[model samples]
Target: MWIPPPVRAPIGGAPASDRRRVCARIDRLVSGGQRQGWPWPLPPSGPLGVGRSRVRPGALSVGMRRRRPGEPLEPGNAHQTVPPLPRRAPRPSFYWSDFNNVAREVREFCEENGLVDERRLPSATELRFMPHPRPWLANGIRRHGGWKRVAERLGVRTATDVLSQPADASAPKLRRRGGPQKPRHYWREWKNLRSELTKFVCENSDSARYMPTVDELEAHNRYDLRYAIGLHGGFRLVARQLGLVARSSLIMRWTDLTAVAAEVRRVAERARLPPDVMPNERQLRQYGPRGLVDGIKQHGGLSVMAPRLGLRSQRHYPLRRKPRLFWTRDEADRQLKAFIQQCGRVPRVSDFLDAKRNDLLTALYRLGGLRSALERVCAEMDIAAVQRQDGVKT
Candidate 1:
């Protein structure tokens, strides 16, 4: 290394050993112990020691960063800015004015479209095209009850109000949304339904009280009448209100004993029994509907009704009681074994019910419970082994 004149002059006149030692000290001071064969200079031999790079501190880094010893550490650059959180959506404020605005919009829409009735009024989902805010309307509907209630409060016709009207007023059908509205059911009114029913009966049966059944209406293609009847109550209720009688119940006028007696005699003869001699009640049941038995009972009884039909009434005999079977444990086990054999295994209560073995069932119930009674029977008869051999669970 070529030393500067001023720096080398001091060592030039010294001894060889002295000059060599001075040059070594100058090299170490300039290099600061930096290693060779490296792109950048190595750091000095202490913690937080700056690297002895030829490049100046401010020049190597882009900024004028300088730190003195013993200062508090700070976070990354304060110059960086982050976008603030998006502003919160404003909470809805419910007001009657908002509700009324939506209602008026609906009303105007209905009027322009010739919707004079409540049944065909547009629902909330269908009101999207209106100018009023939908959220406010939804919240208002919830707060004030429901959509139907809100519509009613706003004086807009609703389905409940429209149902009781006698006839749906005909509106000029237009090609509107939801396919030209529901094909208006014209006879929705109570008075109109009754009159139509009366007219139908008079034309078909020529009897004012002959109320038509649902099947008759369906056969003649009067679906509207059936629907109206269901809405009011049902076929029976409507018939009762109009003083009408279905053909099924027309012959149910069992209050007249003379007519009832004649019917009974007719039924008895049909059953191949002698009509002159009063038939037993069991004989009449085979050839007649249940209503016949009910009617006879209503009039008085077979004894009273028989004489009126010119049939000689049979002598009434007092029924004698049969001997009651005392259900012993041995008797119960025998009956249960027989029942299990017939059923091919243990049976449920319904099996006893079906087999008409109420006495055994009563006795089983009289014992602790069915489980213990069954266990006692199985133990006494060795039935569990038999059941196991028979491939049935005991």
Candidate 2:
């Protein structure tokens, strides 16, 4: 006994013979049995026969003519029996009807079984009979302006719906947290203290006295008052409000030293110095505050005072020397000898001067004059060779 070949299922899951019979019925229904005047080429079979004919690849048999490239399909030549081409999904339609009603059904279903949980939405198994079910529902809602709009039309409150509600503009904004509120009496005290401080700064601020130092303020018990003003804004602003010029630093005014220097110039003129010579630090020191010495040094030193008095002078500050090389005389000699041995000859004076070991060459010159140093090194090389030979013989 032989095994028969397994019958291949027809395209629509029917037997081949059954498919022929079905196609015959469909063809008769589609073309009304008399296809002589039909625009499309019919199957090459008898009027009522059930034989199926295959169209050649890329050659559609239509309108009794071969469809050529670039030729548009004639209206009457559309393939009535050919399978439809696979098309991509169309753009979502915004005018979907009954969106509210469909959404209502879904919302009711979710609420009925508490299936509204976003992390675990109701599965499609429960909605098997519904057309397109949850996926189509979501797409339709999205197409018709989002889930929030759908929820509003269905009279349901979803997370999306709640979030979509506009915030009330009339609501008061919350204040940012900060330090504790200052007491009412503390504010009153602040006003009075600031006024007094202003008056004090105006009276004391002058070219002669300038702003009081922190130490001086501490003596008068106004240091804490200054700190309080700083916490509110800063001392600079308070001083500015009082029409007092703020100094860069608390210790001294920029012009204070210049004024003192001016006084020293007057004293110098009285000292009978020649008109062309400005007084130096040693001469200017005897005329004013001892602190003036350091101030003079900072403001480009005593020479800076010369130009101001229309006198010519020059500043002379000490210059630093370069450090000495690390190598000793014996080490330098060994290095020089090794260099001469590698080079196959002693270096010329100019070559030695140009080398990194030029300092060593300078030392060699001092030890035994330039020409004499080369003679000594050549003599040492000969003696070392003789000693090596004697050691080998021993």
Candidate 3:
């Protein structure tokens, strides 16, 4: 037997010209497709049966036109045929006749089930699970309106329909949960918070006079009361409400010296300090009752009061110093010159403030004001004089 070379379809059937035309049409459908670009020229959109023809490397040899069952094979490719592209099904649209049929079925089903389960109507999900499921009924219901509106139009009773029967305008709307509104938190109200604060202070503090700090509140895990404090005003206002005096207010007020002495001793006892150790005024203020430090001050100050409470005087207050004599003119000029040299320009009042030199500021004011003094200094140095920025005093 002779082994012949593989034979291809005739060139005239699916000719190169027809292939390029078909490929161009396909490229319009899918942009930048393999056949649409590279090596191949942008093809002319010629009708079937005419154009200059050329073969592509991997082109298929199917005839240009589809042949029906009885038609003879095309000329160029005798054996191969190109099936026509599939046509899409037309889009389904809402029609009254179809919708009425779907509605009639739904109504009949609802009527049959009504006696068994009152107000029974099939949901889309329920329709899908039925023995002879009708998908069109659900789709029709969706197209007409939502389930509720459709049910309402079809005389089906929803929960809202059963409940809103009374037409009284003044009738109170029912809450989702029955009964009066549930009691809000006590901290939500100032009066409630004050009472709660009284209880909290009495129970948690060393005595009735200690007000809890923010840190103490956080440590106790009662950060919720942070809201309470803001609603009722700050710690001092709250302490005043409770008949407790702030140490600052207590120091300024005159109270019985005997009571003050007694208060100091009481604070030392309950100070949260080491046992048998007495506290100074600072320590008593930190850990004792609100008025304790001031009480010590009222009874001849901390130095005198500490001995009575068996505490060593901490000598905590800053010692007073005499104000220095005003700076001489020469000294003032020397200082201003040095400052200008460092800055390379006349410095502003803000520069003095930023450097924390209020004493130098006082000396400048005393030396006949900033500009007058700086002008004298700048003149002596043979430099250009500077004026105060925007000159008029605020």
Question: Each prediction's TM-score against the native?
Answer: 0.27, 0.22, 0.22
lDDT of 1 by residue, 1-394 (tens): 1112332333325576754564454445346534543212212223223333321231122221223223322334344333233232454455444666556655665665445454344444433333222333444455555556666677665433333321213322222121111223435678878887888888875566768866577667777777888988987888889998755453445657766677677777787766487767787677765567778877666776666677775556633322466677677778888888899866777788898877777777776556666677667766663232232222
Superposed Cα deviation of residue 220, candidate 2 (Å):
15
Predicted candidate 2 versus true structure: per-residue lDDT over 38-73, tens digit per residue: 433333344424333332211121112233343333
Please report the candidate that would top TM-score against the real structure: 1
Which lDDT tens digits does candidate 3 get at residues 1-394?
Answer: 1213423334455676754665555445334533554212222224222344433211223212222432323344445443334333343565533656556778665554342245544655445434434445666666655566666677775333334312223323322222111133545677776776677777786767766666556656666665677777776787778677444334433366666656555666676555434567576777666776666655666666656656664445543332466478888888778877877877788777776666666788877887788778888999875655853132
RMSD each, Å? 31.8, 33.1, 24.3
The alpha-carbon lDDT assigned to residue 331 of candidate 3 equals 81
Q: List candidate 1 stretches off by more than 4 Å.
A: 1-191, 198-227, 239-259, 314-394
Clashes of each: 1, 0, 4
**Which one wins by TM-score: 1 or 3?**
1
